[model samples]
Target: MHTTLLKDFSVSAAIAGFVTVLVGFTSSAVIVFQAAQAFDASPAEIGSWMGALGLGMGLTCIVLSLRYRVPVVTAWSTPGAAMLITTATGVPMEEAIGAFLISAVLITLCGFSGWFERAINRIPMSIAAGMLAGVLLRFGLDVFISMQTQFVMTFSMFCIYLIMRRFSPRYAVVTALILGILIAGSQGLLQIDTVRLQLAEPVLTTPRFSLSALIGVALPLFVVTMASQNVPGVAVIRASGYTVPISPLIGWTGATTLVLAPFGAFALNLAAITAAICMGREAHEDPARRYVAAIAAGVFYLIIGLFGGTVGSIFAAFPQELVLAIAGLALLGTIGNGLLTALIQEKEREPALITFLVTASGITLFSIGSAFWGLVAGGLAIAISQVKR
Candidate 1:
């Protein structure tokens, strides 16, 4: 893997990126769509986002891996997309676009200046592990919690997944997704009418730069996305024992986001949970070959951009429970490992567990997501415990 990327390409590497693409796009594409809805994005605007994000992620990953000679991957800003649901609302789309650009600039600054790396150095390994666990735990719980209302639909899918995992673990997630769709359609749990088959045409919105949008949406978003998401995202790569260039990777993602902001690309950041899966041994035994997986992901993302509405509709077709169950199963290993890592140390264990539990509890305070507060509370716990000593 370290020697050179092209040198590592194998038949196995070729499919790694494709598998990554399906996992990423299928897993949380709907949530991203819902987030766009909160910002009052039209279908075209949403598709543009999907398109630009695909283009940015694809171009960057493909370029950087070949250029840098590493299995480097760039992901659309998942946390930033997550933020739009609650924070990007009421702001004009143009201002949000401006925010996207501004945030990209900041991200670039972080990379060029090496400030992010410097700051990351200060974080205790245990705390970083805890935060990673905490962040992923939210999605982990969402997987099952979603089933509370849709049990029959979810349970059947779970059973199919179990059977597949026993027989063919490699295709378990994909098979489960397929079975979920079939069962959902049969049960009448799938909703197909809302799907618009038209190709997504990019609507150019003249960006309206506002200090207010920068102050409200852009700054906090850049902070949370970088600190909460990218920080852990990078950690996942390092933790998985991959040593790639951090600064260049950040710069590439930031630059890509800057280019696509005109088309409503909100944020582009490294993926933590999902990227780890692709980078880890599970994706391929040979580390040198994982770039192929990222390439596959890029190709799939391009396809998503081409048929944004149709692809979006297909994901929406399955009963919601099926998606939830699949996500839970796919992420279960990462979640459990993260929690175990977070609590392994004696001093940090309690605080880390508090972080995980509070984050998992889904208690939102003062309009802020629990992901942030979990960090705050855990940090406070660590601080106070330190002071007592």
Candidate 2:
């Protein structure tokens, strides 16, 4: 078993895993931090939040990927965290924890009951592909957008990425990342001085359920996580052509989040964006070997959990443009694939285009994200077309 595992692992897979963690943490971690602060959590409590979330994501990503032999990644719900920042204001920390627990319970129920998967399955693949494309469109655009401010670094990474894609496709993202880091370091853009090594200790908060929190915080968190995060997450997995069982994936993440919520794991769900980093061909030439990338990501998540503060500071030290450039470059393949799949079916093309446009527009309504709205709009378009037919 050990020898087989060793054989399956590759340098490209490991680098993909590292990039997954880097993009996941650097992108929305600060919003999570702000959400913690909204509940008036202390610094130690915030670290505990990071620790619990890291542990939950790590466990799910590793165990699920190994079990299914697919790149099954999990992440904290960024939309849920954003909702918390607004709704958790003035809510006691204890009550907020209780709300987190409630949200987890709801997610777990949805998973075990298989309702969420059933609903997701009804949505046609083209529509799902459109939603996935919309969600990823920003990252693809950001590769060039980063050039506006950091032309030397971003453009160099982009050129290296294209060159690598033409010659050594498997190593393109990793090569681009290395070049970006080297250039950023040379430009004195890396803030290496501020990172301090510190072990994160979990600080437990006992649950104190309140009606207001349950109604205000828990329900909204649950809704946003399901609609905005998990929906697109499942879409990514399917669009990538992986048939891993979605119910168990959702169930395990909910179970993990439930276990860690008291320690500040607000919400855990399937990962869409970072999962693409691991699922794409860039992770490995053979799709069967791509599970190694998810396993590698799990190891990195454990490191982040154990040394939450240190890892957070390390991610923070990198220049924003470098992160943006690398992420955009890494995801280029997945985004292009999504767009192609979305428009391939003539019957679904128009609706899929609507979904893509609405999603890329980044419009939010009733606190839900563009992903959910895009799905709704596409679904409606399909319904209308059927009626006309």
TM-score of each: 0.79, 0.98
Per-residue alpha-carbon lDDT of candidate 1 for residues 1-389, written as tens digits (9 for 90 to 100): 43554566554444446545655777667767886777788877888878777777777767776665456666766656777777776788888888888999999889767887777665555666666677666556766787788776677767776786677655565566667777778878878887776676777778889988998888877886686567767766665556677887887788878888888777778876556555644345566666666665666667777776677676566565665566566666666677777888998998888877776665655445565576677878888899944
For candidate 2, lDDT tens digit of each residue in 1-389? 56867999999999999999999999999999999999999999999999999999999999899899999999999989999988976899999999999999999999988999898989999999999999999999998999999999999988988899999999998898899889989999999999999999999999999999999999999999999999999999999999977888888888899999999999999999999999999999898999999999999999999997689899999999999888888888899999999999999999999999999999999999999999999999999999953
Q: For model 1, which pairs clash?
A: 16-293, 17-293, 17-294, 17-296, 17-297, 18-296
- Top-lDDT structure, candidate number: 2
Give the runs in model 2 whose Cα sits over 4 Å from its true position.
Answer: none
Q: How much is 178 displaced in model 2, in angstroms?
A: 0.9
Number of clashes in every candidate structure? 6, 0
